[model samples]
Target: MADEDNPDSGGTVIGYERELADITGAIDRYGTGAPSHIAIVAEPMAGRTTLVAEIRRIYGDRVNYLPLEFVIMDSTVLDCSTYEGDIILIDNCQFLSTRKIGGFDVLDMFLRTQITSKKLFITTWNIHSWQYLCSVMNLDAYFPTIVTLNRMDMPVLKQVILSRYKPGEIRFLDEGVAERSMFFSVIHSTMRLPFTSAEISVPWIKLNFTLMLRKLPRKKRVQISLEDVILEKINRIAYGNPGVALMLWDESLKDNAISLSAITETPFSISLDTNESFILSVILSMESLHAKDLAAIAGSEMDIDRVIYRLVQQRLVRDNAGYYSIEPFALGPVTDYLRKTRRLW
Candidate 1:
């Protein structure tokens, strides 16, 4: 059967059988004359692009895809010229709505369009944006269906990585090693906060790392276990972000290793106990604080410059503009620690 007739057949749509089924079912009900679009949310490298590709392959040209990235403009001015179709896959729709622009207004208008027009639209957004949209702005009402792609579990992640290796080379992943690597991979993935831009897929970091690994001397390959190094570095640099991991791995080949030492080698590590307390205090006490504010909070004991610098580097906090705030998720840990130490309310 041609893809459009089936709407759920593709290699890229692996492990998402349920999501596919739900989408196709929705399409079948609403897609014949006009389609209803959905929102597919996932962390970076969680395979949003692949999902869009699968949707396109299944729906064929019946679906028009507009991949949105950093260039998210207002819906009022959006030119949907090439977007006339039964199904529209809007990848990285998060760019359209963020804290910078009044994302709520944009999302509100976009959702209104989906309802007024029977266009079956599937949008993929960063988890952060989705949370802000749904929780902060109460925009979840606009989305009839929402599917969140969580971190890949060990077994699944192992299967995903091993699948990339050819049958012959795949045997190199000793039983325990694959599982162990995946464990770390998942841990690394959780460290980086979730994002929603489906511009790339799982194998995003493939060739870059492989080409670099191949450059090693045959002797070093045997001694160092390139696979382990690759997994470790990929786990760290990309934080299980297949795209970023692959890119960093490739760059490492050209550049140098991005090891923990290299990351810490920067001249300082944030004094966790003291610095975290001070920083959190500043954030909680003030209406809003920036990196410079963090420096002030650190007082003379620690340099605010270094405190913000290190926290951002470690992914403990996010600095948007000059505003330095702990990442939304990371706040849990920081808050818990501070409370335990009698920091704040």
Candidate 2:
């Protein structure tokens, strides 16, 4: 079998070529007398984790990869006094600290170690946590190289998903929903400026909202195929998140086949008290946390069990055994809510 046909090899490397160049360039510079630490900033499904994997694939054992799957306690964090490769890659570095008083102690110690040690560090962070830390701890000053994984456009998103399969492998079954103009609708896009983290609103594409205002009966239907429509819907809902798009594709596909109507986007409606909102925001920043860590971040006053119960009841968070995190479909709504409530910086 061809390598491209294998799903394990599929990645958004094409979309991330520029970012890969920037990071690899930083690593190359590390060999010089002037070495620089780097940080990869992105949301959960934004492909930063994939980029980290690519880095590990390239450098092999030369780079030490430490992926933080859950919240890290103070006793477990490395002081950087010990041994490892000269290059260190830490994924999900947001777990380095929590959002409470004295919570940043571990992060402070880690930063101090990084400052004194000569090891080249490449770390990844959840964007919300990174922003909060930037404001509160001045984290921007620690890393000279910061790579924010920008959202991809429709074409790039399409390419990344399609590249996962061999040509003509999966059949696209059109369910005849071509009349709706979902792709070129007048929706405003949130465009983030590179490096500066500034954002602006731009119309994605201009066209009829739903084509529901047609006065006369159309003589012929639109020529758009079911494949295009499905891709467009996936792109719109995923909002340029490659990982999320892939997940939706897998969820929609049945027996190696897909239809335009098979893809459904779940809209989220959330209302929570201050403590619940705060705890949810912490989970978002840290990705996932156990009950103990959540309670630690929630502090003494907030009833951790009650807050978790409310969040779970609302379907805003999912409990995998003991680890708690925002539901995949609720990611957008939860982020918006936290941002609006000033819970996230």
Candidate 3:
């Protein structure tokens, strides 16, 4: 809110003040006597890039930045020997490895080089990839300070969105409608075990009070702002990922006005076979990949074309040229599915 008018303030970087401070503090400590490396980890489109940009803004010319995009850059560029800065910033470190080849070799070399060099390395990683690498290589132990972004609260999310627009630039519709409340009944039953008696709780569907309330006349209910409802839904679908939230906001907007009914979430009932699911997870982790890369990751046995066709038909994936990626709105649902299936760590 303080920087609402400041053109340079890249919105509120909400929910990350402490993280920014810790990063800067580490840099300062390293400058004086202490030496440390930092890792900023978050899910895809969770503002890792924005956070890194803020870091560059804060440090200015004092820090050297190396942003990595594995899809476009060669793997050999990861060599840290050529970089001559005391403070190094690397983005998308997840690209160090791919599904076909275990890229721990490059990661090992990078880590070895950084550990020996007197430099403060600040890096960002995809949460899933970070977890995988940590499990495989104990990667967390290498970075003395690691800051993870958590799911943001409603108010912070609101501020983050509001910061992107000038006051009154966009209309927030408020339809005077009270949201329906859900209620459930728990049934307690007594059961006899083989050797002992026990009481257990069972959940049962109760009357749909919310539905009944919705049937009432509009005049009798307390009106909730449509803008609040829309934002709440966007935040929910985004799972507190700022980038995802912004994308949802842009997609939902119609002629500069947003309505509660206009905001919709991708259905989570996607059906994928084992191989399809694995390929989807790979795409989500990598953000995007070519068919060849997907095949390499899926292994020789997988019919990559059939899987891609199925996913595309379901609207779960979109193909650009030969590259494949999860549809924008489908990101949340895909992530939820992966988390449920333990594909995402």
Model 2 agreement with the true structure over 1-345: per-residue lDDT tens digits: 112233256443767787889899999889766459999998877887678877877777788878888666674567554646788888899988887778888898888877777899999999989999999989988998888786666666777877768899999996746435563643445677798745444656655423333423565434544575677778677766667777888899998898877888787789898999988998888888889988887788889999999999999999999999888777777887998999986
Error of 3 at 174 (Å): 3.8
lDDT of 1 by residue, 1-345 (tens): 112123455564545566678777877888465444577877545566666777787778787778653434458544454576767778777656544334356767777777677667778876545655666666566666666665443234445555544554432332222222322232412222358422222322223444354557875542445355445644443444444443444443323323332321011232465765666544533313555434543557776676666677777667778876555434435444655676553
Candidate 1 weakest ten by summed lDDT? 261-270
Candidate ordering by lDDT (highest first): 2, 3, 1
Lowest summed lDDT across 10 adjacent residues in model 3 is found at: 182-191
Q: lDDT of each prediction vs. the true structure?
A: 0.54, 0.78, 0.72
Q: Give lDDT for model 2.
A: 0.78
TM-score of each: 0.54, 0.86, 0.80
RMSD of 2: 4.0
Count of backbone clashes for each model?
A: 7, 0, 0
Instruction: Please provide the root mean square deviation of candidate 1 (C-alpha atoms, Å).
Output: 11.7
Candidate 3 Cα RMSD after full superposition onto the native fold (Å): 8.5
Which lDDT tens digits does candidate 3 get at residues 1-345? 223234256544566786678778878888655468999887777767777877777777766888775543344676666666668898888877775566456777788777887778898888778888888788888888887775565557788888667888888776433233322222222233465322222323445344355457997655544465567667767766677788888887888888766677676578788888888898888776878777777777988889999999999899998888788778878887987888877
Candidate scoring better on lDDT of 1 and 3: 3
Error of 1 at 132 (Å): 1.3
